[model samples]
Target: MRRMLIVDDEPLIADGLYTFFAKADIEDMEILKVYSAKQALEWLDTVKVDIVLSDICMPGMDGMQLIQEIVDRWPRCKVILLTGHNEFEYAHQAIRNPCVADYLLKTEGMEKIRETVEQTLKQIARENDFRYQAEWFQEKMPKALPQLQRQLLLDLLKRRGAKAWMNLQEEFDAIRLPFRAELAVLPMLLRIEEWGSYESQSDQRLLCYAAANIAEELLGDKAAVKVAELDSRSLVCYIQPHAGQLQQHGLEQGWERTIRFVMGTLESIQQSCRDCLRLSVSIIAANQAVQWGGLQQSVNRLGLAVFDSPGHGMEKLMRLDITGETAGLSLRQDKLAAAELLLEHMKQRLLEGSDDWMCSFRQWVEITGEGGPDDPFLRLRLLHGIADVSLRTVQEAGLSEEAGREHDLAPMLHFNIHTRWSDIIAFYRETCQWIVLRRRDSCRLDESHILMNIHHYIKQHLDGDLSLTRIAQEVSLNPSYLSRWYKKVTGRGISDYILERRVEKSKELLLGTTLRMQDISGQLGFSDQHYFFRFFKKAVGCTPQEYRDQRKGAAETKM
Candidate 1:
């Protein structure tokens, strides 16, 4: 009886397979079912299984990881993938991998699965036979070893191979054996990256098996490759080639073609993995006869080339400058830093009331709005910048009081400009903007229009000493939390904004009419002219009188 492990997240799919397998009359198979890749791996640690059937996608640590683990721990285990998404890459990749036994699309129904299973089992049996025959032939080949001694040696290698291989010459001399050549070893490295798709874990496992199959085919009879996964996103294959076979083949173009085929097959599988899963493939090409050090250098070069080359979807082979082994993580970090700087720059402009604020505001709006829900906060912070622009606009205009009419401020909002912040902010910023407008309307009409009510509470009594804490109380929120929330939504602190508006009103009173500085200060709720002068200097970097003088000089210069 053969042992099989079935991995899939969906109960219906798993149960369906259980029923189908039972009906197939393959009674000699004992099946274990697991819902996740992690569970499958845990089971693999202790349970010896002949075959594994896995789904492509699951909640966490998906099928690709499971397949890699199987190939690493049990190279002989046959993997059959049953996936729902139809993509030729899965089957093509599976055909390329030695570890994968078969690929069966779920849509093919139970009959096809049964057929694939039988074929896989048959193949496994044939390989086992080949291994035995190869061992036996090695023993009888007189040039290699005499038949009688060769048979004994073969048994010793299989039974206590680790110890025997470590001290082969010593053991041979002790046993009166005559083979005198030094031992040689060849190493192959295989690395796989995950598809950008969201295929079921079972399906992904099957795809991973397909990748392994490609590597297996490339090595053929000349090498033995062990499959393992580095993480959720990558797979590793270790290849040990037979020196004699490699000498006969030399460095062949067929091996290069095999690498291309593996990459192409992976591309095809990614297409089936769902549109989201993008893939990039990289392969290392080296002379099979090279020593372990040269091989390691070659593999490292290949790795750098694979990761460094820029290509979308599946890429075949990347040639590396074997002289250098540098990676590019530092470059990627610099790009991330640049993105943050750009975001912060936009926020600063929005808060400062620049006349070209609309352009910066809109850019921020578009970036965050497009960020989508998966990473909403990261992009949404951009929206907060837009809201900050709008709120600061109102505060700067000294219009936090309910507009006597909406049209009065409509032009300032610049809603029609293609790159206006208002349009970019759209629904997200509008939600908070409505809060400010509602406050203003509530005080103006003594009636609650949701848009103007909040502003009304603040304006009705300026002497009430309004702060985010007091303001948020009317809106039902904790002070600190509301302040942070407002800043996140508006890109400016509530306190800074209120001060800007108050200072602007004081400036308007001082310049537009003959009101004395003390009278203007008193009317705008400043304690005195001195206090107002210091406040104005801090905000504008000049005293009130100096600002007026500059404005007068600027007007005369313009005239």
Candidate 2:
């Protein structure tokens, strides 16, 4: 509802306007009367006033001064000036202030005043509509721009041939990319070697994005830098020296210095990622810059170098000369890729509450055990991957303590502790089975705990704010989801449960206490006694007083 304040130094005028508006039947509008500018300012301090009608010549603070205060406090509130003097200067000043709706002589009848107030309300509504649309576009543009830039970069990364690079400068400009087209750029690939506590794909992507931000922050001053996530676990950064830097140091020396600075900053970036995000990353950068046309080949070379590097879960920084042959890298890459796929599939199945993940684990073990001598590096990679999945699953399910007590599998993650492949495989199999069983028990316990918390909060706050939004906040859940889930779990709606509780409380108060109807209704959170009486009669098939009398009579007869 909109509130309008009527302020005049004279009591007669203020009270008359208030009485007229109170009886005028202005829908959804509340009129308040104040005798002076001081009283009006006090009211505005605590309440929102939509329109202010005040006399132009008051004693201490004139209507013009009050308008300025209102502008500062509530910029949306419209002010109308009324005065006995029909002075031209007052009208001119009122017209200059945007907050002043109209300047009028006191001789303008209350009807004219009422019409002006109604028009001011319509003006407020129109302004609110325009503001909402502008706010929506402002909110959406920031979120949309990033996705557009990412898609453009991905397209450029995959495009081939000179024709693909024809409009490269225009595409970059459209997205506001910092790097200049046709300039030699330094390309670096960042791979998350170990995802400490992050398990979900979304969480992993967030960490990768944070890592990219850290890269930009550290190296942005030296070069024009743009970083984009290639996947959940990796992102690529393209860096080019700014024009001024290139002119000062010549083209060759400028790129050399920028590349050197980037290489030196990698350690700092890695430290920030480790400290802030708890992620270990491996960075591979080219020792020399590559032309825009050859960016994809350079990125590919860095990817192969990462795949061939040993010690899968440790952080490392490698500089590629961009001229090595990746002949023998394919075989190892295939093996690692297969192992990663199998582990991811098993993780998904386990989270879905299935026993078939054990089958996938067995297949992975077979893949690791296949053919041509024992590659300890490959086994080490598989061991760390499985251990990570198992530990994260146990932690996410809140069964870490139980898993620790039941099995001492922590040492299985260490390569030296379980050097034998057979021993590692046996431990891995036992961990998988333990996860399946414990997860089932954890699910039941989690549901029970959630229901208990929700019910307890509802009971304690029966007379307070027990809205769906409040209850969801109490139990840390989304309001809409909680409503649907609670109904599905209890076979009754939450609102129905609340109504039943209120009725039970009302009955208890009626039969057990000598409280008045108003007191009982207030205690039970009803707005008034009449609403309470109607609600109680509809629910219990009798009015509250009638139900109380009948129950008491039945008890007296029994005695």
Candidate 3:
């Protein structure tokens, strides 16, 4: 429905247009008549008008200044100026504004004015649909906020340093993490020691998601846990006990309670994965709760222990035990080789867009950085693997003008795993973020490209076959895929687009050329004139002949 405000200082003209609409065939309109521009503004303050018609010359606020005021206040409202032949000079200035739909000479009849009203309503409908879609997206984005927030927290940790920890503390409330900065946090590292064979990337990803859920679900109540599924089948949980429980016990006792809670949660998680998910997981937790200042080094030790010493079979629970010499150099080399192979497998999983690839990769980098070889030669090999994985993942993500910038690896190339721990972790995280942002952009671009191609194809082939199969072929997409994708992207079906394009083209040809209705119908790919007539009336609220006559009459009146 639409509202039309008719403003004229003259009683006769104002009442006449109001009566004109009251008696007209227009169904969805609230026709209003106001005696003066001031009265129209008063009514506008109370109600929003979709269309405003006012005479150029009034008492205090003339139509020129009145239209300007209405435009600023109700920017969406379309305005039309009515002027006598002498007052037609005002049309020159008023018509310059985008808000001024068109101006009519008072000498022109009211039916001509009603045609303008119908056209404006069509535009308002489009604007309202767009606004509704924008509002809908705003309403839905909050649901994804938790996932995004957790990802941000994990990214912050990868950067390390006091600055990153401080930043994480600041964001705890915003991301709705279930913890406070002052509470004791028990960081638990969960490693999937075995999960049988995995071939498909989708399967690999689903298993990771399943594992993360099992861990979070078991540990969700007393603690605020942020889990990152890192590479090589490890899950890192940043756990903070509820503030109320921590406050009652004081820092020391609360810390002890958190450790016990975390241990119990890990054991439950292991059992759940085995029973419910049918997989084996090893858990390594930080021995003592450390404040944000020493959180990086503390969690690093746990990550290493979880990956290096994943126990055999069901006996997969322990604490950080990496504060010892290696068993033997050759044995360590063999373990590292196995780790490197697992990392390569994870890299493939991520490229496949597996569910928790990013989390898994970060876990791999963090844990492996600890247990990884200290010898410069062996460490260099590990760094190279990390660099290769990072670069390849970034490319798959499509994050930059040139996604495969191996130059980013040049810095890691000169560095090793042991001494440059912080630098490598930071690089890994930065790369992950870059990958995520770019991949999102790529997906959006892909959607936009499909829509643009479909639209262009429809417009260019208005007279040709405009079937879904034809349009899809032109765009090199499957017809069914294109149909759903086009509707999803544009909020309307491909056939709807074709019909709209045909109608718009018919209008242009109707007004611009003296084409016969049959010829025009044929050119628009319509089978016959009657079908075109019904379609034009249904879509435009007027028959094609009525629309053309109105345009012709308006042109002659202007002349």
Pick the TM-score winner.
Answer: 2
lDDT of each: 0.54, 0.80, 0.70
- Cα lDDT of model 2 by residue, 210-310, tens digit: 89899989989798888888877889888899778889999889888888889899998899999999989899888888888777667777887886778
* Candidate 1 lDDT, 1-559, residue by residue in tens: 4667788888657756754674464644555666778877876786567888888767776555677789888889988887788767666776687888777778888778778778888887787786767877666555644334435433331231144355655755644453332532232333445454636777666666565555555544445443434334444444443444436654454344433444444334334323323344444443332332233333444444555557633444443334433433223323223334444454454334333434543554444344322334433443344445455645644556644444244443443323444445455344334434554544444423421445666555453445343475577765556656657756886656667667767667667887777777767655446766867888889988888888878889999
Off by over 4 Å in 3: 1-138, 197-199, 293-296, 310-315, 321-374, 382-559
For candidate 2, list the clashing residue pairs, or say none: none
TM-score of candidate 2 on Cα atoms, chains taken together = 0.48
Error of model 2, residue 352, in angstroms: 6.6
Error of 2 at 55 (Å): 24
Give the winner by lDDT. Answer: 2
Against the correct fold, how does model 1 do in TM-score?
A: 0.26
Model 1 misplacement above 4 A: 23-27, 88-92, 130-132, 139-559
Instruction: Write down the RMSD of candidate 1 (Cα, Å).
Output: 32.7
